[model samples]
Target: MLWKVFMHHSSMIFLGLCSGSGVFYSLACLKTGSCYFIEWELISINSCCVSMTLILDWMSLMFLGFVSFISSMVLYYSGEYMSGDENMNRFMYLVLGFVMSMWFLIISPNLISILLGWDGLGLVSYALVIYYQNEKSSAAGMLTALSNRIGDVAILIGISMMFIYGGWNFLFYVGDMKDSINKEILTGLVVLAAMTKSAQIPFSAWLPAAMAAPTPVSALVHSSTLVTAGVYLLIRFSPALESTISQSILLLLSGLTMFMAGLGANFEYDLKKIIALSTLSQLGVMVSILALGFSDLAFFHLLSHALFKALLFMCAGTIIHSVKEFQDIRAMGSLIYQMPLVGIFMNLANLALCGAPFLAGFYSKDMILEVAFMSSINFISFMLYFLATGLTVCYTLRLIYYSLSGDFNLGSLFNVGGEAKIMVNPMFGLGLGAIFGGAFLSWIIFPQPYMICMSMGFKTLALSVSILGGLTGYLLNMGSVNYSLNSLYFHKMTVFSGSMWFMPFLSTFGVSKLFLQSGMKYQGIGDMGWSEYYGGQGIYYMISSWSSKLQILQDSSLKVYMLSFLLWLMVLFFLVL
Candidate 1:
């Protein structure tokens, strides 16, 4: 009956095929270097032509391997997680479609081909976000799609401009174009596109809102495919942005995003949202580094962040599933005692996120902070970087203290226990990657020598942000005086931070509320009153009046016509006399 209801074998087989292709292609890239080919010719009217292309290089190859591997693990994990769902087949198919789109995105270098993947991500992710078919899911999905549509439009504009270069293959021109007005335009468009996809600053409301989807989708979308697409595009196109105004804007926006996400995560209580905020923060780090002319480092951090963030999401899914409907930290406490394995994995991920010692996050995050410091940036960027680092540790420690070790406030009736093999197995695979992914990728990805020279001030601050934020987070949460409410006494600040500085408001109702009210006012004055009365009612009344007058004239047509003619003749004779 289960087999009839859900097609597991086919899904598993697809996953295996992807995973095998990824591993094989990654190895092949190491030996053969970058490869590109036109998959098919779509259109060739006159001199313009569009073709599907697959580009394989060390960069695409390795990222594809990682994405495919994670998707496989996630698919495996979902088998047990979604076993009870009524539409398991639908969910699986959506995920498969999502993965296929991601694959097309990974291998493409042309602007037109990339659109196929980029738009697919936005559309498929919307479907996945609304998979639950609830009000919350529907709202989140719309926000996700609309926000992404901004990037989609940006790419479309960029594609139109590509006619200047006589090719739609952006990968060729992005790195090779010399300084010119047209090149700068291309660079600006690329940056705009990247910012939206990566959820940077103004476009950030969608990432956290997207937590409405199932956890596995979050793990995949947030960690590897959707969000990282922007970062990868930037990394590939970093050369176009070098020494341009676009790069400076990127630095500023990324720094702000880092600060906002870090602050929001510290204030957030929802389990999934906190992790989602962390992903946003890490994306900022990636973008910031890329803006500073460290594409390799950015790519490195991207990989490391993906490994641990995925694991972290999976662990969060485990917690949510075990506890049923409760996701608030206040409702969850002393979870380590009931489910030690999941707890261990969760803490491990949190530690890695905070860049503890040698975990996957540490390798890339440490290098990123160091490189950021060495660069001569404005004071604002400087503060945002270090403060964001501190804020990250602050919230992660808060997470552990509140959820892992605090009092068990979730009522006694709910039974919390270990997860089944189907759930736990995928976690272990990713956990192994989380633990060693950073160290391994650091060596593998950066074969060439990467160096940074920083003064003592930068180094000291870099080290201190983590230590101080960690200690303060732990003590603040642990102290008996610091209970949930009325403890901090800074109500305004808490409200600001907790409400994501009203970003969700600013992104959603904040922007629309004023316009919507203005629309209503215009409707009342223009459409309902003047336009309706004048255009519709007034026109009708004029037509009716004319019709009545004409009818009267028609009824007395013979008499009226003779009287009018006689009156006109008399007037003419008087004028002549």
Candidate 2:
């Protein structure tokens, strides 16, 4: 126990220090306008010069700094959040292993090395997701793992394809393969891999299901480590993905994903799942922007969103912890009265999510929208973008209303105020980031401002949708105990929207339903019916009856044995006659 506590504190402090150093070095790299590419030549095969390569650029360094910082805070938060678990040591090690994988992923420009990190992430995430050892967690872990495996397979295929180019260092060849047919195929594979990892479109069901993991794990995975890996990879590979066909496809899928997630969040009641949906929504925003040919903007939002989203998850964790581990928003209300500090931070994070000016989300999210609006995107893409933005605010306000303002719902006996100092302290660090991390990153990432040439109407469109969405969301959710259930009234639509367009069913139950049914059928007829009747039970019954007759004959008296012999002789005489 003491060692577990030490692991948490020691890792937190060490990561915190590393975060600072990474940021300092990143700034130095930016100032010098230079990057360090460290290459260690491994064994040469056919003079191709296979080497372990690291890209120590400002971009990689800065991202490392942010990831390390969020990870440090998450570790400190977990020290309190996971303190009661018997296997806290395993939890600590798993989280650290996750961080290490992200590190390998960030620095490696070689596809071969990237696979090491990529597979590590998928495996460790499965471990973390199933940490509770419950049926739900196991199912969720399976979904998460299998979904990410698609990306892993895509990466493996890409590696195999890259071998034709003499090496797996895709960074060296992405630019040169622009017009090559193989390059297009490789880019498609990379996009597919990114889509699966980032949980876009048809592959999105796992993101929300993954909420079954512990809250701290949710914070780390959703914010910095797992989901963002895909976006980060795209940012690194942006130069190669500039084809119009790829961009258009990415835009469409990501837009739909953004809209779907935001719509789903409004209907969701589980606090953690709602946050998970929000993460999905934001991931959509990142990928959509990346598809629009602004990888830097995508990268910018990635960092800024990480800050507040991590904070958001932490706040949600504190609430879940306090409410006797019940995650339903319907079970929690007027928490502001009991846990004022948490309420403040939670509301702060929510508002940031709404892109209420100047917060971390605002700086990145608002800009992304403006840039999208300004771009030459099709009508469908444009409408999806704005609709999704509106839905984001809709859910955010709805969450605040249900969880913060309404009546106090906890029982009178429950004492659900005053969070642990450890939990609250980590929130403070993230809270500061949620407030100003955007502006800070904006200045650092973009030395020059993005020039906007839009009219006044276009400028206010984002704010307009946000306000409209919030009002609509709040009013729709406002009701007394006698309020009619919207879900019951509009069952079909509710089920469709609330279930992410039946994606979970399709991804999990739908995909496996046939096989599961077959197994049940086989169990009933093959194993329990025919196989048992004829194979095991039939033979047993036959043997048992025969042995009983044999025992009876063996135990028979002399008269009975003599009568049986006479009866057999009489039958033989009759047959002879």
Candidate 3:
């Protein structure tokens, strides 16, 4: 029993090791700046030595530390949350594997070695997503896996193209690569890979659906580590990608994704999925800022967002698990009365997410918007940026009203409970971080403050949007209570917003249905029809029929053979003449 107890907390032990590594490496990085490289020569490839390169820059070390800290807290919480499962050991191992993969990804600068971590994250996450082994989990796992495969393939293609640089190491030649057609292709491919991983725009359908995973998985992977991988990759490579057409495309798509996800979250009711969409929205913001050429700002936001978003997911998971697994907002109300911690942490996480001043999100999110206002960006991106910022506050308040502050609406069987130390302990660490992480990262990332030479009106734009959006969200949520307005009156609008503008449909059955029908038509008309008949089988049949006649003539008798030969010779002679 004693040994079993130790094994039960094995996840936390691994976290300790990682935490130590992060501390040692972070201090080392501070002393060395960004010049630390751990290169191990692997087997030579075509006379060029292929080596594994691990970069111990402040970025990698700090991110690894953050990842480790979050994972540690999550694992501590998982002890009670997953205590009953017979496969609890498997869950622990998978989560640790995910952390290991993420660390590998963080340290490696070489694309080849990074793939080891990249693919490992993809694989382990798939396993974690489908850990529950139900229909929903299966389908969600497939969507997440297949959506990410495009990025993996793009990276492989980029690797093949990297031979043009005469090396597999892209970190060395990132900014030095000349802008040419080949470079453009390489740039586009890398950005596409990042967008796919980051859940930007068209590739975003997988993030919300990925909430089919367990709540712990949501807190660990979707909210923090895995989804942010793409943004981090882009930030690392931004020097090479800035001012290119690829970044331009990212600018447009990320803006759209930011707006789309915020709108979707406002209308969503599923607690975990709402948080999932929020993660996607934040990802869009990071990518947008990255494309705008403030990658350090983007990286700062990434770290800050990870802190709060993971906490948000943990709170969401607590709520969902506490209420007998009822995750729908319509099914929960006045939860603060019974579960004060959930409500408090939920509100704090949401506040941080809304970019409340002095909180983590404010430091980075505010900086991003102020920079955008200062930059020479187009009107559409500008509008999208501010609108999405407002929408973030809107959805967060709407979530508060539905779940935390409203009158009790849950079923009689529901019990608002999070009493276990295992479940509640993690929220404390994350809660503190959610409140301070953004500010901490800003000071570290930007030792020198930004000098924005903009009008006060432009400077206050982000705060104004946040405030107004919060008030509007409060009014909109409470309006139904005051006047008892029927949602059916705005049925079309609600449906559009709630369904994420039919993005899920458009990404799923919309695309699947169209492909299925198109495939049938192609198969019937082309593969099974004229092409097959005329290209292969039809020619064979035609030649076979002719050959039977020729064989009969040739083998029938000596006279027939002689006649055939004579005709052939005559035809040949005539052609020659």
Candidate 4:
């Protein structure tokens, strides 16, 4: 009934519940200094039923606070931003569903309930992404859904592996199966899933695509909820992944990803794409920190990243909406005169993102870098870390300078001025949070023992180097070079390769031709093989053929009906299994 009431009056009810819950949770945290206090009781549901145990800890409380805080802000912002949209009702439903799933995910004591919440959140995010129902929106939604599903399947398999070899009880299973399961296999699968969900490396293509969704959806799902799920998984299963080899792989993969994505963002023209790549880089940093055995650093970065990234995205949204243009950055210039407050907020958020001193990102990111430095003196890892930090500074400053510093050119269009009150208000609130939230939190949230902590001098030195790199890039922009070391090398490579023609030659003729032409004998086999092997045409053929067959199968009434019933039965069986 309460849910029904919320459904009926979603904006007011959700706002009230989230606000009240956040206040309650914060007060509880203050009073107890802990988030979770577990009480276990056995209850009989049926003659043969699985026994369940409830467990709560600081981790659960931390996540609960995160969900409550972000959800409340999103809801408050959305109430005004989405006021009269036709899909507002549906959006509300999805928002509530997302919040509930996050709640369930955080509080669930066992893997099963957590998986349920995980899948639920994934589904809700997909629905919300397509709420706009445009071609780009749907495409982005499908891409995100598909990528997450791949991760979900990996997680399911890992969980099943745990059940089979590690035992069915999650907490007790860890100690029992320490020697039984293959650490390599478990770690490999978990890392794969984590990378995909967190938008790390190769699987990261989906997140920037997801920028086609509404700004609120981007802020909530991409910035706060879905991206953080993978981090939560790593922290939750830290014990299981404590082996030296697993930690090494995690560190290397995350470090490389951070460097690559940050580099990518430095050259990106789209505003949202820049932010999207930054999200990937930030997640990599968090993962790298976790791999270094600094769980506290990961958690701290998670909190700080959530606040600043969401604020940055919201500020970008305001800019895009007011200008009535998708962000190319090149098309934007000197809006500070017209949108002074928005410009100021944007600069503040960007400064935090660049790890400016005394900001939220600086505190958390410096801790991670310090841990990385102390973990190993390996030159390779150190260089990778340095490069990632430098790239972070370059891209963040690129965003700030390109969008806010150039001469005021409205382009072909006239002045659009600032955004509506609904949008501006959220920007203001998030901006304030981005600037001051970290200092306030440093005092209030950091344990008493950690309260007097200061940034390491070495870390400060590293940050100064990063600042110099960014400044050099900014100064270069004043010249007519129009290219950096990265772009120059890329241009030379393209020229040497005859502008992407050599790509096919190298991939197909040089390598794939050797495979296809040497052994195959069937008629049309060479064509199919070459297409699949060299030209990359086979994938298209396969997909088109499979889709056609699927369409035909769906059109068969008896087959369709039987398949539907079978699917229903399977779902029921799983539910009761």
Task: Name the top lDDT candidate.
Answer: 2
lDDT of 1: 0.86
lDDT of 1 by residue, 45-116 (tens): 568678888887777877888887888888878887788888887888899899888888888988889988
Q: Whole-model Cα lDDT per candidate?
A: 0.86, 0.90, 0.84, 0.70
Regarding lDDT, does 3 or 4 come out ahead? 3
- Give the C-alpha miss distance for residue 136 in model 4, angstroms: 3.0
TM-score of each: 0.90, 0.89, 0.89, 0.77
lDDT of 3 by residue, 382-459 (tens): 999989999999989989998899867888776677467677778888889888787767766677899988898998
**Ten residues in sequence with the least summed lDDT for candidate 4:** 496-505
Clashing pairs in 1: none
lDDT of 4 by residue, 1-577 (tens): 3443244345544555664565466656666766443434344333322333344554566556556666666665666566657666677778878877877766665655567678997898888878878987897787788778888888777766665543334555544445434656666677778777887655666777778767777887755688888887777666667764767878887887788777667667788888888888899899988887777678778877888888787778778876766588877777787788878878888888878888888877776777677665478778888888887887787777777886554578656674667566666656766777667655555656332333566647667768886986576554512345455657754353222223224432454467555656542666556655656676777788999988977786897888889999999999999
Query: Model 4 residue 6 lDDT?
Result: 44
Q: Hey, what RMSD does candidate 1 come out at?
A: 3.3
Prediction 3 TM-score vs. true: 0.89
Off by more than 4 A, model 4 = 1-56, 164-169, 175-177, 443-445, 448-457, 480-489, 492-577
